[model samples]
Target: METDGNGSMEESRSKLLLYLKLAFLAMEPSNCLLSLAIEAGGGCITQQVQNFIVKECFAKNMKETTMNNQAYIKGILKKVIANVESSSVCAEDCLYEELAHYLTIGGPPEENNIIYREISFLSSDLDGKDCSNSVNLVAALRCSSNMLEGDTGCSLWPSSLFLSEVILSHPEMFSNKSCFEVGSGVGLVGIALSHVGASKVTLTDGDMSSLANMKANLELNKLCLDVASDPMHPCAQKVECRHLAWELASKAELQDQRPDIVLGADIIYNPECIPDLVRVFSILLDNDSFGEDKREAPSAYIATVIRNLDTFNYFLTVAGKSMLSVVDVTAKTQVPNLLPYMRSYDRSSVHLLRVSLLSE
Candidate 1:
């Protein structure tokens, strides 16, 4: 992540505070948060950090959060006190009291597992511009606790996070361009595209439940949902979300969308879906004009993590057979790491693939 390393001490502390608060809101592990606190305290968890936690982070979260994820917060408070005690420093009394309150609140863990994650993309050091008023873009989303349960699309993926950084870092690439996304999980990339001022965005997913959740997340980010079925009474929203099964996607349905740019995050993992995916891409990236001269084919940028070599190669082979060219642009692309506060996300592990038609 591109951090403000050369900034003044005050700026560094401000970043620490922001990072800590964002980590807490993101439900980061307590140990990860403690490390940030210790750095802010210059080797110890100071009384000032304690007060900030109690007054701003814990207090505000407790009061405003409607989710039943207090268990996570309770764990954080416990770890904070432990850290302070280990360092031979006395923690603020209010911190202990906050822990006590969480002790009293009890409920079924399963019922209140759903939560809204505030994904913030800090821009202070993104482009070397330090404007306090112009903070990062925070996209609030309602996500399920069990990401791998019935609906995996409801969960956030690291590739999406990486892709988000790419979109925010290089807004020029997406701004004023017609963008479409495949497997729009949690609708994070779509939100990033809209933030970058994409002229038109069309997001599609195969799963019905995920499609519903994607719409909700888009609305949560203040972007209205536009369905492709209704063209006459279109809303003011520039972003559109639709359900599209790759295996069932017809050529006509695919031809209707001729975006300047196509995007996907973590959509190439499944080996079973590669064929249909390549088919969809082939149709989408094929020549859109009927004239003798062929216009520029729409390009597709796909972000993925190379988990298994076999699966990755399978996707590449399938794309090659479908007359598509895929370039490994992970090192070539310059995407500023806007989400440094999110310690859980490993930006390096994510790779970028620049894909487009290789001439019919």
Candidate 2:
């Protein structure tokens, strides 16, 4: 019985470690952190768990970026301290020391905060390799504290994360292909495409601020930004950033783009925008003029989280009317969970659709 009890405790601790790691990676809210810490401590705030939160999570996060919300960190520490006191557990000295440090530093900067996220992908190398063989792609993204800023394109959504994982997991599909992404928020998917050795990558967003932020992120990652005279031509540099509003984009301009693959992440939300979005898709995916080489035609991979049934159905209706066929390939395709540490990202909520122009 004592041995069984010991095993149970060990299992709980293991689970706690996973929860803590995920919470830190996903940058969960302060309240969520307090709850996770409590769970890590077996329903109480333990001193050891407090130390882990301070030394492992908070300290590491602070060092990773100067743009981190110091006030938010301080608040989380205070909550942890209060929880420890309430639970009759003594909090670590480092927690108080960090809280004092934050008090001196004051709040985060007024500018948008930049977060460096390391997205790891488990390598498909089947040479009897272990989990340690995974690869990490680090991206520097500027995101607003408020979710609605930059037309909501400045925020990192779960759909983008899911799409990025799909790209990384299926490198063969994107490698050496010319890929274009619409509504490329934060340019996470663009970075992923470059990592997978895409021959040419074009990232476009309708929002000016989002476009600027995406360009900054691309520059931060040291990926060259190519501005081509002909948007249809393959980019001279590995990545290209463009200001493309679906509603405003000219049909001639859309027809000029000759990408082999098209991609979008979380771009199917607005019901009003569905018509223009599908119109853009129609021009891009219509390869009847390019001859009957099916392999040469562009295919679209859209990752979207269906928040409203009406909005999604409306998109489908608009797409079908635009001579586009949308197929749900989320189950058909085996996309590995590359970002296992991102607990905040509900990949299950995202659905991958394969879109193409119907045969003439």
Candidate 3:
């Protein structure tokens, strides 16, 4: 097909605009459009059109763009948002924290803050060796807090790094396994399981407030999901949420289900709750034959970025014989060093450990 000069110029603009829209859509779309607006290169387009759409969307009290239309609308708006990275405005801690802030159903940013998380994975498709992908997920537990009140600073803590490093190192351990994550603050690892096609994923946290926030973020990202039955709806994954407390760890059986894999992130931070967290993992792992997919020999993968060796040792000591092996997961690339954002007392202080379970 031959095109005239005007057609060629229009096509060029279309192509450039297409990339811009894709970038904005990639930013979480279900929540609010403030991030989307920031993503769409806010003032680039005919300012009148931008103002018209924003005003209309608000005038109608439309909270978010639907899942089915999100990518499409974003694609159309590409001309507006030219820079993909800018569309992903929520990159640094401030913006990242803001995205998380809206995803959380309730709670203040002071308690539920976002933190930089590092994760590495062993790719079977890549010849069974480890590859690393660093992304952020939410975490409820803090390294220095027992006060579990309405604190937004507690949104997504740095502890998410520990969880990500573990999953990245031992991706297979989670594959085809029924996984249940306790205290799933931001659910980074739990969502990661669904990404790898795990048998099932259930994210639980004691804090109802955090759980609500986690669910919002999960739905917002479409991370761990199943399809919506309605044709009018988009496909989502299946990730369940539950309220659980470590003090009641022994009551895990009460849920009437046992998970093949039990995971936690930054759950060992509070020294006072160390025993409870250990107890929770123990109960979740004790019955190997409980879940539907009872394998010949069941295993587990625990990832942690511990700043305090004493605390790490404490978790290991409390876990006792359950800790079969430990491998330190190192970053494959230095381009995105996690330490800068982690701000650990010692740069090497944040250790990513993979603790395997004893075969049962």
Off by over 4 Å in 2: 1-22, 35-45, 62-64, 109-135, 149-151, 226-236, 291-295
By lDDT, rank the candidates, best first: 1, 2, 3
Q: Give per-residue lDDT, candidate 3, residue 43.
A: 36
For TM-score, the strongest prediction is 1
Q: Considering TM-score, which of the candidate structures 1 and 2 is the better prediction for this target? A: 1
Worst 10 residues of 1 by lDDT: 227-236
Stretches > 4 Å off in candidate 1: 1-7, 62-66, 106-109, 124-131, 226-235, 289-295
lDDT of 2 by residue, 135-190 (tens): 45656566656765444887889899889888888889999998999999899999
Q: What is the C-alpha local distance difference test score of candidate 2?
A: 0.77
lDDT (C-alpha) at residue 169 in model 2: 82
lDDT against the true structure, per candidate, is 0.81, 0.77, 0.48
Residue range with the least summed lDDT across 10 consecutive positions in model 2: 126-135
Rate residue 185 of model 1 by lDDT.
80
Task: Name the top lDDT candidate.
Answer: 1
**Residue 77 Cα positional deviation in candidate 2, in Å, after optimal superposition:** 1.3
Superior candidate under lDDT, 2 versus 3: 2
Per-candidate TM-scores read 0.90, 0.83, 0.50
